[model samples]
Target: MNQKQLVSSALASVMALGLVSGAAAADDNKGKEKCYGIAKAGQNDCANLAGTHSCAGQSKADMDAGEWKYVAKGTCKQMGGLSLAEAKDKTAMMKK
Candidate 1:
């Protein structure tokens, strides 16, 4: 095969693999829920409530109330975490 064709084929394969893995990850989260006040610094799953940043692994403190991570459904409370609303209130309180 030509060098151009080889590179194109490799890039296509990589893109396809990324799509498949992303879909698999979404499926894996079907049984999970967003559990706030549980993520440690640099361990959060996504954006925080305070809007300090917008990405995963950006938490600046442990259990910051605004930061969260995915945990098993119905297990956030057992893990000493709070719901979205409760977390929002706590975050607001922290700002006062």
Candidate 2:
């Protein structure tokens, strides 16, 4: 190919790559489903990240009562478990 054509092709390839990479999904905050008159609920998947990461949102009652303090955050590949208390502790530390 001519010099100009080759350069244009390279530029197009780089732009395409950037678009693909940027399009990848990012970690999103979990969603809270309002727990009405019900007393208890089971584990619920909140968000799916990159076909690997999955999370479980804590109930509103637990958050308000501070009874079951915890949230699930991790990827399907490398998941690090965290309890509500532990998460609170971590957030406190981060604020410092």
For model 2, residues 1-96, the per-residue Cα lDDT tens digits are 899999999999999998876665222334322222222233334322122324445333322211221233333112333444554565456558
What TM-score, to 2 decimals, does candidate 1 have?
0.74
Q: Model 2 off-target regions past 4 Å?
A: 25-96
Each candidate's lDDT (Cα)?
A: 0.95, 0.40
Candidate 1 lDDT score at position 34: 98
Separate clash counts for every candidate: 0, 3
After superposition, which runs of candidate 1 have C-alpha atoms over 4 Å from their true positions?
A: 1-24
| Steric clash pairs (candidate 1) | none
Q: What's each prediction's TM-score?
A: 0.74, 0.28
On TM-score, the candidate that comes out on top is 1
Please give the TM-score that candidate 2 achieves against the real structure. 0.28
Instruction: Quote the positional error of residue 89 for candidate 1 in Å.
Output: 0.7
Where does candidate 1 have its weakest 10-residue lDDT segment?
87-96
